[model samples]
Target: MNRLVPLAVVLGLTTASCSGGHGAGSFLPSGAPGAGSAAPASAGARTTRSTAVAAPPAGWATTATQAVSLKSATDLGALDATKPVTVRLGLQLHNVDQLKSAVQSRAVLSPGQIQSAYAPTASEVAQVTNYLQSQGLTSIAAEPNGLMVSATGSAAQIAKAFDTTLHAFTVNGVSAYANTAPAYVPTALNGIVVAVLGLNNVQAFATSPHRGGQAVNHASPADSAPAPQPESPCALSSVFIVGLPSPQPIPTPEAYTTGCPRNYTPSDYWRAYDVGSTSGAGRTPIAIMAEGNVSSSIADFRVNEQGDGLPEVPVVVKQVGVASPDTAGADEWTLDMTASTGMARRVSTIYLYATTSMTDSDIALMYNRWVTDDLAPIGNSSFGGCEAFPYLDGSMLVDDEIMLMGAAQGQTMFASTGDTGSFCSVGNPNGVPGGAPLVEYPAASPYVVAVGGTTLWSQYDGTYAGESAWNAGGGGLSQFEYSPFWQSGIQPVGTTATGQSFRGTPDIAMDGDLQTGMIVYIASAGGWTTIGGTSLSSPLAAGVWARMLQNHPGLGFAAPQLYHTFAMSNPGTKLLGPPPTINVGPFHDVVSGSNGAFAATPGYDYTTGLGSLDVAALNAVIGQ
Candidate 1:
C-alpha cells in the first residue's frame, strides 16, 4: 500500500470525506439558538430568527443608487447594457441581517425578506414602476420577482439614491424590505434591477400586525464598515497529487476502506491542516457546488471517525432540478451531475438544470446556485454550456457575475479547462465526433485559474511519477482578449499580440486520469460509488486552496502572485532577485508527457504551463 500523502504528517489532522454524508460528518449544525442570535418575528419579514435559520442573500446588482434586492434582477454592469440588458431573479435569502451584519453599516435589508418571505405586492410594483416612469426610467419589466428598470441616467447618481432608501427604511423595530448592499453590485450598463429590501423582508400577513413598532436604524453605520487594512497577498503553488490506490478489479466491499491499500482506502481524502494560530482563530469556510445531498454522508464520517470534528458550519442546500420547490430556476441535477465532487467542510450543494423555459438570456440565475453567508472559496463548475465559437453568449456573463466577482471578492475559483485535448477540433472518442477545437467557456474566463488534467504512474515500490499531460488535457490560443497581466509568459503559437495567439489556457494541472484517479464515493444516484474526472481534480484543488487561505488570512487574489513569483523570473534569476526567491523554490517543473497532439515539451508547453505548485513554496509566495 502507498503511504498516506504528507498532508497527514504536516497537518496532523486527517479530514476524510465519503460519497454521501456531510464532510465534517456527525458534526452538522443542529440549528440550535446561540446567545446573540435573534428569532424571526414573522415568516416573510426580516427577523432575528430568520437570519439564523438560512443562508444570507447576495448583494444588490445595481449602480450607486439604482441597485435592487437580491431577489429583484441580475447585475447588468458586467455587460454593457448600453448595448442591451437582460433581467432575472435568483437565490433564496434565509437571513437578511446575518448577511448585513457581515457588512454592518451597509446593511440594506433583512435576510428573510431577500429569500422572498416578503416579495412586493402587485400594487407595490405598480407604485414603484409609476415612480420610475415619472422619473423618466423606461423599458421596465415589473414582475413578481422585482422590477427591472432601465433608463439613460447617470448610474452613479441612480445607485446612490437607491442605496439611500434601501439602508434607511424600517418597520416594527426591524428592517422592512431587505436587499443586498452596493459593494456587491456589479458594473452594469443601462439595465438596473430595482430591489425593494424593506418590503421583501416581510410577508404581507406579518407586515400588517407589526405596523406600529419603533423604527429600526437601517442606514449605513459610520463605523460599521470593515476597517481599512493591508490587502492580503497569496500565490498559486504546485497542485500536489495524492494518488489513490485503484479499487479491486471486481470492486469488493473492502475496496473503499483503510483495510484496502492506500490508493483504494476512503475513496476520497481531504487535506486537513490547522489554519490561523491557536489564538487568532482564523476561520476558513469550504464552499462546495455539487449534486444531491451529502449531509448524511458527512454525519456518518464524523460519528464513525475520531478527528478534529467535522467542518463546523450550516449546510443550506437548495434543489435545482426540474419541478423544484421554486419554478423560476432550472433543474439542478443535470448541472449537479456535472459538478458532483466532495469537500472537507460543511458542504451544501444547490441543484440546477438549464431548461427550455429558461430563455437563452435568462442565464444569470445560474449564479445563485452557491451564494451563501458562510464565506469560503467554492469548488467550481465541471460541465459547461454548449458553444460553437470562441465565445458563448451566456457563458461570459455568468463568469463575470459569479466567478470573476466571487474571486475579486476574495473567493478562489478552480475550473477545468476541458477534457478535449486543446481548443482546436479533434476526433471523437468511443466513435462520437468532437466539435471544432474551441476554448471552453468559463474555463477560458480570465478570472479563474483554468486547471487541466494529467496522468501519473505509481512506481511498484510506491512513489509516483511527476505529472504528465493526460493525453486529453485542453490548451490552445484563446478566442478572447487576454484579461490578466500574468498571461504574458504564455504567448500563443503562431501569432503576435495582435493575432489569435493572444488568448491561452490550462494555467495548471492535477491528476485527472481515470487509471490513476482519486478514490471518491458518490451517494446521489444510490449507494456509495467511486468516481473521478477533471471534475474531482477541481474540487480537490479548491479544498487545498481553502486550507492555504486559512493558513494565510492575509492572502489576496492569486493572479498577481502567479506572475510575480513565476512568469517574471527565469532560469538565471533563481540566484538573483530578492531574498525569498519566488519561482525556483515553489514550482515543480513538469518536464514530461503530452495531451494527445500537443507534446509536453521541456519548459513551458501547451500541456502544462510552468508546471504545478509546491505547497511549501505556495505558502511562501502567499506570505509575500
Candidate 2:
C-alpha cells in the first residue's frame, strides 16, 4: 500500500547500502604500463580486451605477485558445498585475425563470405570440451557457435575446477556467490580461452537502456501537466508498454497519457527521416535481444504497428535460454520491440529473445543463440555497461567474435554507444575512482556499428530545422582498440597521433534527446515519455538496414562500404562525397553540441559520429 516503495525500486532509487550493483568490485589502479610496453603478463593479454574491461588495468591481476582480490562488502558467511550452480566457461574463436583483416580491409562482402571462412573449428571445441570433461564436470552444453561451454555442478566442484574459492557475495544489493581470487584454468584451455564467466554471480552484467530523461513513478508535481494527454488509450500506439512498480500487479500493457511529457512519436521519426514508402515487405527480420519478458506487450505492439501504417508483420517471442517468466521491466523490452518494428515496417518478422538474467554469460549466451539459430539477418542490442571495469576478466566479451560471425553470415549489428555523454565512466556503480573518461562496450567493438545520439531541434510539424549533438550521447576514444584501416580518417589518440590511434565512437547518430526523443507507449510510466539515447539510434538503424536490404539483396556488413566512401576521408581532409558543409548526403552532419569533453566538429567527431541519416541516400552509396 506504500507508493514510495515501488517508485524507489522501479526507478533505481537505492543507496549503496541497499541495491545490488558492481559495488566492492571497483577498479583500483596499481600503475600498469600501456600496450607495447612491458606490462604484467596477465595485464598484457593484448586484444580489444585492453580497451574495455582491462582499462587502467581495471581489477585484473596485473602482476604475478599481485593476486586479484575480488573483495566483498560482507563476509558472505560461507558457501554451501551441496548447492548446485551453473558456471560458464569461455573459448577463443578460430581465425580471429582473419576476421579482423576482412572487416578492416574495407572490402564489400557477399552474404556468407566471411562466416564460411571463420568459425569455431572442431579442434578448438574439442580442446575446450575435452578439458571440461577432464575436470569431471560432465554436464556441459556447448553453445551453438562452439565459442563457449556451459556446465553445472556443486559449488565446491565448480570452485575447484575454476581454481578459486567460492564466496557468498552480493551485487546490486542482492545476495549471490562469487570468486574471492582470480580463477585459474588448465594449460590446455589457457590461451585458447579468452576468459571464464559464471564464477561470480555478483558481477554478472547489468544493462540500462540508452534513453535519456528522468523517469518518475506514481506522481510528482511534473506529472500534472495537461499539455500532452492522449485522446484515447490507443492514441499513442507507437509508444512503449512498460510495467510499473510492484502491487499494481495486473501486468497489462495499458496506456494513460494525462500526465506525460510531449515528444516525437515513431510516426514523427518516420516523417523526419523520410523513410520512403516501400512495398518491399518480407525482406529481413529485426531481432531485439534484451533481458526480462516480452509477452506482456504483444497486444499493444499490434496497435502500434497498425497505427504506424506498417504492414502487418509476424511478431514472434522466443527465449534464448530458460529465463525467468516473471513480468519485470516488461515495458522497457516493449519499447525496443515497438520502436524497431515501427521504424522498419516492411520487415518479414520481429523476434524477441530474452535471457534468464542480464548477467554477462546470460547476455552473451542469448546473443550466441540468436546468431547461431540464424534467427534473423539484422540484430539490435541496446545494452552496454561503463567501459572502465574488467568486463572481460572472468568472462571475456566474446561479442566481437560473435559479431564477426554475424557479419559473415549476412547480419549487421547495431549497438548503443551509451547515454553517459563523453564521460561514460563518470558515475560507475562500482563507486571507485575511475581514472579517465571512456565509452561503453559492444559499441567499442569494431565489428559492430556503434550508433550515437543527437537532438533534433525542429518544428513538430514534421519538418526539419536543424540538429545538434545530444549532451548525453555517449562517445569517446577506446582506451585499447586501435582504429581499423577503414576508420583511419579519424586521428588516433596515442602521443604521435600516428597510425597507432584508438577506435572512435559512434559511427552514426540519430534523434536521442528527451525534448526531441521517441514518444512510445510506456505502460509503466503511465503512458509516454520523450525518450532519447544511443539505444534509440541502434534499433532504428537496424530497422533502416532492414529496409535497405529489401532492395539490395546482399548488403552484408554495411560498415566497411560505409567507411570506404561517405564516412571515411583523408586524415585531415573533409569527406569527399558528403560535403561537411552541407546536408546533401547520407548523414545530416551534426556540427554542434558536446558529449562531455568531446565536441561535434565540422566533419565526424566523437559526439555525433557522421550524423543522422538520409536512409535512401545511405543505401544508394553503400556498395556502389
Candidate 3:
C-alpha cells in the first residue's frame, strides 16, 4: 500500500494533525438541528425526516442547514456586507422512500413519471421562492423538479435572510467565502428546504485529467508530423512503465509507443477492451457534465472524429447557469467527449451540460439540468473534490437527490473516483500523501457509478494482456456516506467515523495511468496530448454503458445490476486472478497492484474496484 506523507512534509503546515470530520469549529452553528443521519431503514429504503425549528421568543424559529462544513478551511475575515452573493435553496424531495423503492426494484420510469411521483410539490417551490423574494433576493429560479431554488442577493441581505454571516477564507489557496454560522430556515419551511448552497464559494470540483508530458503546438507542420515509430515491441518495452517498480521491466506494446510519451488511441481501447462492433448505435444519448464555454472543445472533438474515420456525433451544449467565456477546462471537457465517443465509435447525441463554474452550487445545477433534460441515459462527470468538501457544503445531499431522480428515470451517471491515490488532494492537485484517506464525492455517492483507474497492459495488436490498479487511482471507503443497499454484501467490511459501513469506490475502472493515457485533441492547448486519470476512465465507462443501453435499453441503475451480474457469474465470490487466462465474468478482475492505503485483491478491493471492463462481455450480460 502507498504510504501517506506527513502533513508538514506535504503542505509545510505547522499543524501537527488534520481533522477530517466536523468538529466544534464546524460551520454549522451550535445546537443547529435537522440533518439526515439515519441510514436507510432497510435494504433499498430511503427515509426523510424534517428538522424541528427551535422555538424562540417572538421570532420565527430556525433550523440549521444539514449540509455545511468548514473542515479544512482557514478563516480570513468577514466579507463586506455589501458584497453580492448567490445561493440555492435545496427543497426536500417528495416521496423519497417511494423513489428509492422504485429505483431499487429496477422499474424504469420516464422523467415525467419520476417528476409526477417524486418531485417536490409546486407549493413547496413557491414557499421557498416567496421567502427568497421577500428577503430582497433577485433572479430567483426553481428547477423543474422544485428541488433547487437559486437566487442572488447582497451579503447583508443573505445574512439577514438565512440567519448566518458570510465570511472570507483561504481554503487550500483558493479565495473562498462561506457562512460563518449555520444557515437557518424558517420553521414554516422545515421540510420544504433542505440545504442552503452557495453560501460558500469554494470550488469543490477539479478536473481529474493527468497529463503525461508537455503538449506540442500542433499548429506547425513539423509538430503535427508523426514521430518515428518503435522498430519492434521489444524496443517499445524500453519505455518506463508507470505504477511498476523499476527492474520489473514488462513487455510494452507497440501501440503504446505510437504517440509521444505513449498515448493510446480510441482504436486501441476498443480492441483492448474487446468492444467488438458495439458503437452505441440506437442508444440513448450521453451527457458530459462540464463548465464554461466548450465551443473550442467541441471543434477539437470534430477534428479528432474526422481523423479517426468516425462519424461526427451530434453535439448539444446546454448552459446550466450564467454563461461565462472561461475555457480553462476545455481540455478536460474535450477529453471527456472524445474518449467516450471514441469508445462507443458512434453515438446518437452528446449533450454537454456546461455550467458557469466548478463551484458546488453550479455543479449541482449542472447535474439538475442533466437529470431534468433526460436527454441522456448515461452521463459522465470527469471532475470531483474530496468527499468531505461536498458533504460539508451540501452538494452531496443536493446532487445525490438529483442523481436519485436520474436513477429512477433509468439514467446512469459515471463519475471519476479522482486521480489521487487513496488520499484526497489537499491544496495540491497531484494529491498529497500522508493526509487522511478519503474518496472523491459523486463517486462516493451511491447514486452514481464510481470509475477508477488501472495501468493496462495490452498486446501489440491491442488485445488485452493484463492490468493492475493504477498507483494514483482514487479508491477507499467514504468518510461520510453509508454503504448503499446494493453494496451490502459485496463492499469490504469497513465503518466510517460515524460507525456505519461506508460506501467503497470505485465500482469500476478503466485504463487511466498517465503512461498509457488517451490521445486527445485540445484546441485551446493547440494540439494533441496524452492524458489519463480517472477522468478518462469515467467517460470510457460511460461510453461502454451507452453501448450496453443500446443492447438493453430498459436497464436501470447500473450499480445494482452490475453487482448482481457479477454475483451471478462468479458464484461464491470466487477470487479472480490476472486476465488473459482467467474467464472472470464481465469484468477483467485486477488482482495486482495497490493505490496507497488499499491493494488490488482478488475481488472488490479499494484500489481497482471490480477491476476494469470487458466491454463485449459486459454488454452481453449487463441487463441479465
Highest TM-score against the true fold, candidate: 3
Candidate 3 structure quality by residue, lDDT tens digits, 1-624? 111121211322222121223222222222233332321111111111112334432334433343233446676777888889989887667666667778777788887777777778888788889999998999999888887889999999998888877888665676767776657777777656667888877555544335644453222222233322334442112121222122122354344443222346676678778988664574568898888889988988888786555777899999888898977678788888888888887789999889998787888898988988877889998877675455544566678888888888888999888777887765542221244466777788888999999987665444676777889898998755666666767776675434446688999899898777776666554456667888889988988887888887789789888877777776225433233223468788787788988988777889888778888888787776
Instruction: Arrange candidates, best TM-score first.
Output: 3, 2, 1
Tens-digit lDDT string for candidate 2 (449-468): 88888766432234344567
TM-score of each: 0.49, 0.77, 0.83
Q: Give the Å error, residue 271, model 1.
A: 9.4
- For every model shown, the clashing-pair count is 79, 21, 4
Please identify model 3 stretches exceeding 4 Å from their true place.
1-33, 36-76, 169-175, 207-209, 214-231, 234-262, 427-436, 495-500, 524-526, 571-582
In candidate 3 the C-alpha lDDT for residue 159 amounts to: 89
Order the numbered candidates by lDDT, best leading: 3, 2, 1
lDDT of 1 by residue, 207-241 (tens): 00101011111111121222112221010100121
RMSD of each: 21.6, 9.8, 6.9
Angstrom error of the Cα, residue 324, model 1: value is 3.1
Candidate 3 lands at a TM-score of 0.83
Off by over 4 Å in 2: 1-72, 105-117, 171-173, 203-262, 277-280, 394-397, 425-434, 459-461, 491-499, 567-581
What lDDT score goes with residue 161 in model 1? Answer: 32
Better of 1 and 3 by lDDT: 3
